[model samples]
Target chain A: MGRFHRHTDGTVHEHEHPDVRHDVGDHTGYRESGTVRVEVLENLLAENDRVAAANRLDLERAGVRCVNLMSSPGAGKTTLLRRTITALSGTLQLGVLEGDIATSLDADELASLGAPVSLVNTSAGFGGECHLDAVMVRSGLGRLALSDLDLLVVENVGNLVCPAEFDVGEDARAMVYAVTEGEEKPLKYPVMFRAADVIVVNKVDLLPHLDFRMDRFLGHLRDVNPHARVIHASARTGEGVDEWCAWLLHVHGTPTQRG
Target chain B: MCQAIVDTVTAHASGRQVRRVTVRIGHLRQVVPDSLSFAWEVLTEGTELAGSELVVEHVPAVVECAACGERTTLDWPVLVCAACGAVDVRLVSGEEFQIASMDVAEEVP
Candidate 1:
């Protein structure tokens, strides 16, 4: 049985039920259960790592920077991608792979920005899969030639949880959050934050009109990810979008051209 | 336990809980079975596969002699065997990430 416990130190731990033992054996004899813990000489993620490395190598060889964009529903992922396309279109031609449970709405939004976008619908036949895999993304890439694009942004299904686990050959994985979400998000869900390289707190133009506390949100974000850069902006008013785009160009597109 | 590792990782895993986790290590991979199991338990503490168990297997590499057709299993990456000083040896298997089947539990309709 799995039992959850909170110690006085406030650290939470789940306990494993010890296997049953036999008392029929002598001091040095054999036992029925709780056998010696076998040393597992296995790298659990061994398979995925190989595929991820290959994906990265392919991206580098093609000179295409792949970025995985993750967020919750209505966290402004497509909106952010649209703004990113418009902002970086001058120097960096962008492509988008929009993963959704259903519909082409997100893909449509991206195409309206004049960006080459592909929508991967994983509605039912995918066995209720929540996130996109490298193989799936690779197949999507096959339809587009990398020579024409500088950046390929994968707007993963609007989920803060599962997308953190799978890698889609992106040079980096970034998380998106909005002011409407509570500050406790990072604490309530840490897996996504742990995997993020950048954190975009969108819809910040509503900060003055909402109960969002910038200090609290920053503290929580820092607690989970101390190194990830956070950009506060309104995808609507394009407030800090320029700075965000500048950072992206520095990391993925063209940096030396910046003034 | 494999289940524990699966459970702890399932929350983070988007596709499926890994069914069979295989590992490959070189003598120089500096990976110890105990340490690996310890890391697995520590990492798999509180996920969807808490109750599952682990299967650990070792892959001993075979190196071929450049001068002679000698096949040796006790070969290291720096295989300057005491028998032959030939620095050219083709390896047959025995690399890391031997993880084979992920074997996610089939979803019921």
Candidate 2:
């Protein structure tokens, strides 16, 4: 159906293979030993792996545990953070980086709680910025007192999908989804919930008032990530805060609140 | 070219009310497709790219050996042939970074 070329005796030989014959010297560097060719199939993710390695090293060196918290806008992320800060303030010196498209409200809330919080206001709306990368996190980290903090929680711009894909040199990725968001959230955003090390079903205090069903919500979460631990809590009330705090301590290997 | 594609796609995305988008970036450029995908996911949410899908088509380079008449396709740049371990080879194809496709859906009215 198309024109191609190849070599033939006395006649124009149509192209048999458009694929170029590789030079044995540099292209392959393949040393053929008794008909056996061996070349390592290195993944393109090598760069990300290298950066991740460096990030892990950086986190270890700082002696600061970083938590990347993701959730929907009104999923009670700030509320949960507020609750956590209040509970952990006396024990752990916590710092935060609040990412928002164009607002300082989240940072203001944290600051009011007497926690060190920095605001990252992105103009992604103009150029179409998607997610925060390691570079952005590093810049925000530079603004914080990395030496003095026991934990640095990066509250990503609320939206479950994109925040899950980024690696901000955090010790672990956690998610806080409010019960009011609906039970089908985990099913729709399986990738995000699956990526999380732990899932917090916040605003349990509203269970009696809202039509939210816990069984279905939890079932979807388990189907998505069988290993991810779930925490039920209300940032407004003091219920389940101790269990959440205990889990944090166990994960970070400190006492009650520091972890 | 890169900015143009991004801008066009972003505009297309905003018009359709896409929350997130995935693009398959072939295995050629230094751009880690994950970074772009991650960027696409976060940057789009709450606006137009809220739930858009990004599927990066990573085209692996194919190589053919001149000495042993060996041919193979691979995802990464493997200079030596895994079959014959010959140094003499040619890259048959690769070095392409294109949107394999886009994932789009109608916005709720």
Candidate 3:
């Protein structure tokens, strides 16, 4: 007899195969083919894309432009977000969906800025995915008041590899690369750099103390993403914050430019 | 990732035990095939797909340029056209992550 077990989650598993004597022409007066081939041309991420479509519709209906921000750990993505929020909060409404492997520290920090913030901790479930896929972003959307905000930014989990794979219904994709991370990052993590619509080179204040070559970095970046707008900024010093804000406003189609 | 693979196998094979699965992943998808295979071995221990082979095929990234009508394969992410240097290029492929086919041991009814 075939041994079968059902888990509480409703997944069925066949534990052991049943032994039976079978002749070639025993069943239905035809020979049994023990092996079969089935063609299934279906994308594994299709389900996630379906949810992402719904998320896109929701954001569109609310007139909220969402940006998915990705980068490696300690790249100052949160700091750049804080500076962006502080620079534009006076003229534009903003909301944040902070993604992390664990802890609500980033969300808590953004919340201090008085902007509506929601936390999506992948570690709670979803196997602590290093990237924020569309399904996760859809779930995070439910926690935010989309109608109250003109723009929503999803700070993806700090990783360069997997984050670029999943699309989270974002109007734009941006990434921050800190100077301290070195210049060869563009080639090492080409997918992340290539997927980004905007690339911000952060921590320019420390460039004088480091051996980072801007030319090599830009060369690699241009080779990977020829169309991405490059911006240099120092979140700590507030340098290039206005230019970045202007670019954001321009891309968002908002007429108001920061004075 | 294993869950998705298991679901696909179960849906296609039904009561049959899966023998092997072939998946086509694109360059831009960022999935490490070795890691996926390792995870599959661990996750399918008690399932019907146990001992099944996981085969991965990588697809190259291709982009079609609107200006020059050039379709070229890109090793990296150069969105611009090589001929005319136009940035008006649309991605033709390289984002795929799909189960192309499966081999299963069919039960003789």
List runs of model 3 lying over 4 Å from the truth: A1-33, B62-92, B107-109
Q: Per-residue error at B13 for model 1, in Å?
A: 23
Q: Rank the candidates by lDDT, best first.
A: 3, 1, 2
Off by more than 4 A, model 2: A1-53, A124-130, A256-259, B1-109
List residue ranges in candidate 1 displaced over 4 A.
A1-41, A256-259, B1-109
Per-prediction TM-score, chain A only? 0.80, 0.77, 0.86
CAPRI tier of model 2: incorrect
lDDT of 2 by residue, B9-105 (tens): 5544434343233343444334566677677656655755556556565667666877787887754333445578665667665645444333333
TM-score of each: 0.61, 0.60, 0.85
| Decoy 2 TM-score against native | 0.60
B11-54: candidate 3 lDDT, tens digit per residue: 76767667889999987776889999998899888987888999
CAPRI-style docking class of model 1 based on DockQ: incorrect
Real A-B contacts recovered, model 2:
0.00
- lDDT tens readout by residue for model 3, A178-217: 9999988888888899889998899999999999999999
